[model samples]
Target: MAATPAWPPRSAPRLFVAGPLVQDAQVTIEGGQAHYLSKVMRVAPGDAVILCDDETGEWAGEVNSAGKRDVVLTLRERLRAREAVPDFWLCAALLKKPNFDLVLEKATELGVAMIQPLITRRCVADKLNAERAATIVTEAAEQCARTALPQVAAPVKLETLLRDWPESRALFFADETGGETAAAQFAAHSGPAALLVGPEGGFDEEERALIRAHPMARAITLGPRILRGETASIGATALWMAVSGDW
Candidate 1:
């Protein structure tokens, strides 16, 4: 006889449900999720879908029923434990909405533990729709097969962020004017760390001085060329992960 399809097939579609998955538990997929499974994926009973609760890690689930508006699933066995993401945060200065959204999405995929949005002098935007921002980050995590979702904190002013900076966490500020090299600094540091990126026009002189004066802030340069807000944010994060994170 042929092998039993390897429990949940590797090709099975994956989803993150609000779950505390237990063996033999049932989950009813509703709203857009249901629509996607039924209408888009066209999953039928007995087909498999990988499910992650963000708390219980990955699980094997079999479709029980594919209704018009909902899809029911039965959890079988645990496939893997929740991912161990590094304690890395991306505290980036806010850019325009679209650019910010791109940073949020990419940060999730790049395995940031959290996103702390900062309001700087040259920032184009001041506020974030919390729910919408969470949705974007969640979708990015799910699409990229990240078991843990990155927390997208609301935007805070640059001064407030600096004032409340955690002493235990190293704040690697991506200063356009430059200080220490990015790779060297990342290699030298360990434990809870965050990368601070500037906005479109870059931080004003006063803001830079304030950040520089902060005890936890370590000024780091990307390169000779000045990069845009989103580019700097993502590029700095990728470099950090390569050196200090679980790359």
Candidate 2:
């Protein structure tokens, strides 16, 4: 006899629910999610929905009932455990709205553990819409099939971040002025680490001095080409993931 196929097909719609996906438990989704299921996906009863509760992990569920304003799902089995996100953080200076938005999306897809938006003297934007940023990351996680979601922190000034820096995490500063090789430095460190990139105008002289003087700060070089703020951040993150992240 032929073996049975998977319950939630590969093409099944996936979502990240609000955690604690207990076995055999039913969940009720509402608001935007409810609208998405009913109106957008048109998910009916007995439809398979792959769910990922950031806390519990991936699960295969079936839509038990669908209503105009709510959709109840019954979880059948856990598909996979929550991902083992490496101890990595991206302390990126805020760029223009569109550019920073790209950073959030790609950073989530690239598997960074946390995102710390920074404000520098050269920054064009000092504030971040936390709610909008969260949505972008969540959607990116869903698209990339990420089991874990990176925390989107409130925007802070560069100096504030440095002052509260944790000793255990190595800080890799993307110095346009240049220092150690990028990949080489990443390969040298393990455990908790962070990559800090500058804004459109790049880090100011004083800012650079402060960062470089920090005991935890190690300068990184992205070859000879000076990339735009968003490019540098995303590119460097990808390199870090390849060299030191969960590649």
Candidate 3:
């Protein structure tokens, strides 16, 4: 007899649903998700799809219904439990569209818990498309095989972020001017932390002072050369994961 196929096919498509999911239940994929699976992926009935809810784990499901605008799936089994991501938040000043998109895509792949976009004096992109941003992260998580989607918060001012900052979580601010090296600093603090990356022109004098004075903040240097906004966010997150998170 032939061996049974893996519950979740190796090449099964992965998607992020909104809430809790259970085995032997039906789920629907609408809008862009539907378009991608039916049109782009060309999935048909019997083709497996891996479904993940941010609140729960992963499920092995097969396409039950497919349409031009919608596709329905029925869960066959639970594949894996929800993964424990690092307790890291990427609080970055907003850059231009292309650069900010890069940060969202890369940070999701790096497995950050949250993505907080901060509006500073030098921020060129004050407004963000929340729906589009969410799509970017969701797709990134699906592509990277991440079970949980990173929380993409609405844009907030730097001052507000500082004022309402959690006292327990450490905040690592990437300061080009002066601070300890990222490796040493991250190694020193392994608890819940957030990395703050400035915008294209960097933070202004006032903003820097406010961040430095914040009780939960720790100023750190990326390296000798000044990196771009997106680079700083990705590099700092990767370093933190290596030093303090699962490597």
In terms of TM-score, which candidate is strongest?
Answer: 1
Per-prediction TM-score, please? Answer: 0.97, 0.96, 0.94
Which candidate would rank higher by lDDT, 2 or 3?
2
lDDT of 3 by residue, 101-199 (tens): 999999999999999999999888899999999999999999998998899999999989998999999999999898988899899886789999999
Q: Model 1 TM-score?
A: 0.97
Off by over 4 Å in 2: 1-4
lDDT, candidate 2, 3-97, per-residue tens: 89867888788888897899899999999988998899999999988899899899988999989989999999998999998788999999999
Give the 10-residue window scoring lowest on summed lDDT in candidate 1: 2-11
Question: What C-alpha lDDT values do all the predictions have?
Answer: 0.90, 0.92, 0.91
| Poorest lDDT segment (10 consecutive residues) of candidate 2 | 5-14
lDDT of each residue in 118-205, candidate 1, tens digit only: 9888888889999889889878987898999998888999999988888999999999998899999999998999999989999999
Q: Count the backbone clashes (under 3 Å) in each candidate.
A: 0, 0, 0
- In angstroms, the error of model 2 at 9 is 0.4
C-alpha RMSD (angstroms) for model 3: 1.5
Error of 3 at 73 (Å): 2.1
